[model samples]
Target chain A: MTAPVDDPATDERLLSAFLSGDTQAFEVLVLRYRSPLYNLLLRSVRDPQTASDLLQEVFLRVIKRADKFHGSAKFSTWIFTIARNLTIDHARRMQHRRHRSLDVPLGAKEGDAPSANGTLVDRVVGTDVVGERAVDSQEIQRRVAAAVELLPTEQREVFLMRQLQGLAFQDIADVVGVPVNTVKSRMRYALERLQAALADFEDHLEGTR
Target chain B: MSTCEQHQDNLLEFILDELPSAERRALSDHLSECEVCPAVAQRLRRGLALAATLPIEEPPASDTKAIMRAARERSGDASTSVTASTSMLPFAMTGRWGRVRAFLVRPQVVMATVMLLAVAFGAWYVPRRAELGQPPAATMTQPLVVASSGVSAPEEAPAGPDGGEDSAAGGAAQPAPAPPDTAARLERGLQAYGRSDYVAAIDELNAVVSAPDADEVAWTSAMHHLARSYQQNGDCASATRRYEQLFRRSPSYNRSNQAMLEAGTCYRTLGNEARARELLEVAAQDPATREAAQTELQLLGEPPRARRPARQPASRSGAPTAPTPSQRPRHSDAPY
Candidate 1:
């Protein structure tokens, strides 16, 4: 019988079982973390295909490196660290590819104001999610997602780990390799930024509430 | 810390239900009395409520199945089910052509056949050439071209220091035609790099760089990626070597200065400060690389060659000038 999926202790045991040749344990672990990790990757890269590929890669790495899990850290922390590193690498590669494109001037700075073409969030938030006919809840979700995307990468990641994955501040610090205070500071900044960006949505938020 | 400051630190913990009860109560009491704190807490709570609206998505069931299959395969239980073997028997026994097709589809069989043909051709062709008193064919020096990803290919003809010396040393011999999949291999390497599988990236990029007939453009790009893969894998020594080779081989490459800066940084990590300084000095001469190179130099305790006006005012405490890793110039100018 499978253990409870939500327990951190169960996660560690699943990993141990996987390392000891029980492939089903690994599957249980994958199912447990799939939604959270996929959500993190999707909001991060803003592409469903890339997120799916990254999700598979994360599990593949866990499978390959199962022996490296020493149990000192929570399994979630280790898995998320791997996921975070891959996303960072994906961002770097995308940035590099953009810079390499012939049409983009070499001197164009990183973090330049989004082109008049708009940000990925603007491009991806379809009429279904943000249209006038959409419900207040959907509109609020669309606005919140767009705002989260607009935050700087550091803040956005911290916010997602806390708000989406419900990672403890200390666990987030371990994953991000920063101090607990630093994680909290980033989380605070992220919330403040989200608040400011969605200020105009106060009426919508209140209506939904 | 001020009462407000102390309470502010606990604000997130309080909302997230992570704070100890005593501290949570203390912050709650303070928030009721503190005008600014309540608003801030309200805003944070509002942000959290709004963010909670973003729906949790289920990944495709196919991806979950694939992950499980991969895990099972890697754990060596991939063959536990005999269905695949039984299913292939009908196709294998269909006809002579079916058997041949099945044989050809086995990678090991195809590879062995290719090797046998090459060996037979070489034995017959080389002796014929010697009998006619003609020079040996240039193919003698060419590395065996493996059609696969080359991850497990023998490294008999290792890439030279600059990744081009072997080809250059071939002198008057006509360059071999690059295998048709050079671009494909390079792309795979880059994809692996993007996935943070640096070891796989190194393998694929190394194969691209070592190809006897890789064009100048592909070879240079492969060398740069190979170096980065090594660097990302924490093999600083190999990374530095590849970076220096890239810098020396193609000084005119658009990103040579960036490579030099990276090589210098790697050297610093490897404790060869003198070499690091040498390369960094050269990198600092390029406008594109100057700031990062100078920052690395500063970290190495070397004074700046010239202080361009600070982009922002120097901090009052004169904190270390090196940019955080995120702020550092990363492939922003790479030619890719």
Candidate 2:
């Protein structure tokens, strides 16, 4: 578990330290959050290369707007809001470049087994199940990614942050500018859809395998 | 069978791993009793773990490096220029001068400049006496508002008194007797304040403050009321100075703490945040002033509530003491 601050709570302590010329605090914040934030961006843009460019934009916007972080909201909430805006901007740019629809299903093929639509268990099971297990892993990652990509934008954001990245419901609510209960409800529906997509696997785990 | 909605909803936090230990334990207890919740929880948890493994490819290293480098460069450039300017000008006097220049460039400057000119003109225009070879202005009014004793009988009024205009009105009309009920007059003054007529309230309160028979209670109340009237009228600088005077003159007044609080509020509202914060620090330290000071401090978002006064260092040496937000009294959020 991430430990709460062991040091005294100084208002603007981190920002003030950064402003007074210590850059390492900025780096610590970056390293602490970069992975989850980058993943969120990657899923939104659906292009790793574009997500990388957009991640830089998000951070650039953060530094540019750091002075505006008045402690009114949690720092991470503010950071994610910036990331959210950057993703929207990236999506718009891609749209202008002839991305006909923002919500294109991923890895949907004619012969893809209905029961083979991947889910989270497959991802975990696929991880340890190697070479011979490789095809199942790819299939699961694809179906799971497709199901997630098909989520309405708002629900998708809440789902990614809550279920995938493990953000607290309150934190996701703050990031998405929704009520906490709304975040919980969105996660519930997202989980329900994933469960249904993988119902066969659930039966198989209970039955033969 | 328990509804999937109810089962999944209860497992939501566990699916996300945000469930506190107590809640997790409770959930475990419930799971043994209710089969549906555990099944849903297990399914959701497995799904989430897989979702977590979804390749969140590292945003390219170049972009990360570029953004961080740009941020550092921008921060460095700004800091260097500031440091250079401050070092070259000693004590950041250059910064102050720049602010003053900006202030003087506004339209209000002309009005202020003219008011200064008028005051300068009055200094010479309202002279005590004309020179021996020169004539005074054809008509001169007597020095205004000198001592006026209680309503004098007409017989005591001097007839055709010297060149003073106010000297004649005094003679013609036996001045009316000073109002008998000073408390009634004070009542009227309080009513004026309720009506938002600060000027009338202040005039009446000033009369009460200066009354020859003004008692300690009346005098102190009148002064506090007058200062509050000035503050309500948006004359913060005047109100603050008046409260400062009141504090020194009547430190033992029953309402001394109230005056101190008003002075601090005036400074805070007038954009003299440093002075306001200093006064708040003093107020926060004094038990008499603590509650009001706490309220104001909370409004300013000074968190962790009150901190204990730190023990003074034995040797006056250590890593630079991190200034307590209260001690430093930074009103960074205060508008200029």
Candidate 3:
């Protein structure tokens, strides 16, 4: 019986087809994951081109190592794990380069780099916007995006994986290599940070409601 | 814990709609009566809504196509039965002339033609060589020396500028033959790299790379290994520096393409996408490295280069063949 190429029931089915020599099945998988994975990577790297490249690399790894994938975990979890590892490597390299150039000691957090202005959170979120004229929804959105950018990498990743990608806390924990409780706590702290940063906007939104 | 503190734990889950039905109902009931709970829930809901506004971007269409093409190519290489079936279908369905054309273009046919031509040329040339009383072509050239292990054999060392003799014989200030100790260090470094002892490899390889008495070949090999050791040890900053140095100092090195591809990857890992693209683009031009470099370039958001239409049989075209058993370079082998 021919496997219908149009719609595969599960990602694992597509991957199995690919292993058995169906290239079209692999294409279906790529199309399915393209947007969510791209957005996840974009949020992680904060650059469109880097995110795009990473998206391709994730699939490339899948293509090369599809056979190594066991059915013990989901195909999504396996692919996401690859993406997370690549991102971690990218962050490490960037951190190493930055530390060398700035003469910052290795293992120093990015937030700890001495700056005249303040920490990223302080600079981005400490502004007094509550007394200003009411902001449109677009403005609120822009501020929210900026605040997300300012989050510590760990919290930002958890927030995006949960809020944007809609990954379960358990799946996120798997991808992050943390206990589920740690993942939940990170998500909580992330929300708390976002709430503080957007307190003024929240007020504006409440008044409008 | 205070009642409010206990409720705060479930507030986030409730807002996220992740709380089970029963727990969600309880939290919803508490929110209606608690003074602080409703405001906290509203704030979180607003935060989640705003964060969701960040756009979900679609990647360029070319990226999807490139990924699929790579998968097909890899699959073709991996499964001979797939290749046979797919390749034969086109031939069978084509018209008579198309079938003839396909047969002519087949790699086996092309290789056979090349072999017949070579034999015809050899028959014409061999008697002339005997008439001239010349030494056989194989004997006229230097014997090919293959290194045993990662250590470069003495015979395989490149000829120095003053010819392959020791620079001391020419009274030049050029780098001399590696001292016994330096040679030993080089051997140890390579052995360490082979065994994945990157920390010890770095220590040993660094000494050989820095030794004044190490010859050009030894120094170059040592530098390559040192860069690899740094990479394996996750010190990419040092690795990038060394790889770049290799490019500048030894541009004509046989493994320069491989070095360029790796350096580009290191730059990418270091978050320098522009420089990574620059190096990968150059490496993509070399046949030996084209596939790997193109893959990296694709990952860096560079469009895949247009593939050549017909596959040229590498052996017939004199392209570099796969490494021989004696010349097996592990993925981490030194460039030398």
Best by TM-score: 1
Model 2 clash pairs are none
TM-score of chain A, every prediction, order shown? 0.80, 0.71, 0.77
Docking class of 1: acceptable
Using lDDT, give the best candidate's number. Answer: 1
Alpha-carbon runs more than 4 Å astray in model 3: A1-8, A99-138, A203-209, B79-336
B-chain TM-score, every candidate? 0.40, 0.34, 0.41
* Local accuracy of candidate 1 as per-residue lDDT tens digits, A1-209: 11125645488888888867888788888878888898889878767888988887777667666776778778888888888877866755564343222122223445654354433344223324323564556656665776666565666777888776788889888887667886796788677657655666666677767
What lDDT tens digits, residue by residue, belong to model 3 across residues B94-158? 47875787788789999999999999989988887788777776333212111211234223221
Q: What are the clashing pairs of model 1?
A: none
Stretches of candidate 2 off by over 4 Å are A1-13, A92-97, A100-139, A163-165, A199-209, B1-8, B14-30, B33-38, B79-336
TM-score rank order: 1, 3, 2
Task: Look at candidate 2 and tell me the lDDT of residue B115.
Answer: 92
lDDT of 3 at A45: 72
- TM-scores of the models, in the given order? 0.52, 0.43, 0.47
The DockQ of each candidate is 0.24, 0.10, 0.14
* Residue B230 of model 1, lDDT score: 85
Question: What's the C-alpha lDDT at position A42 in model 1?
Answer: 89
lDDT of 2 by residue, B16-125 (tens): 56677887777767778864566556656655644543544555666556655655754677754323322221122336886775576466997899899999887776
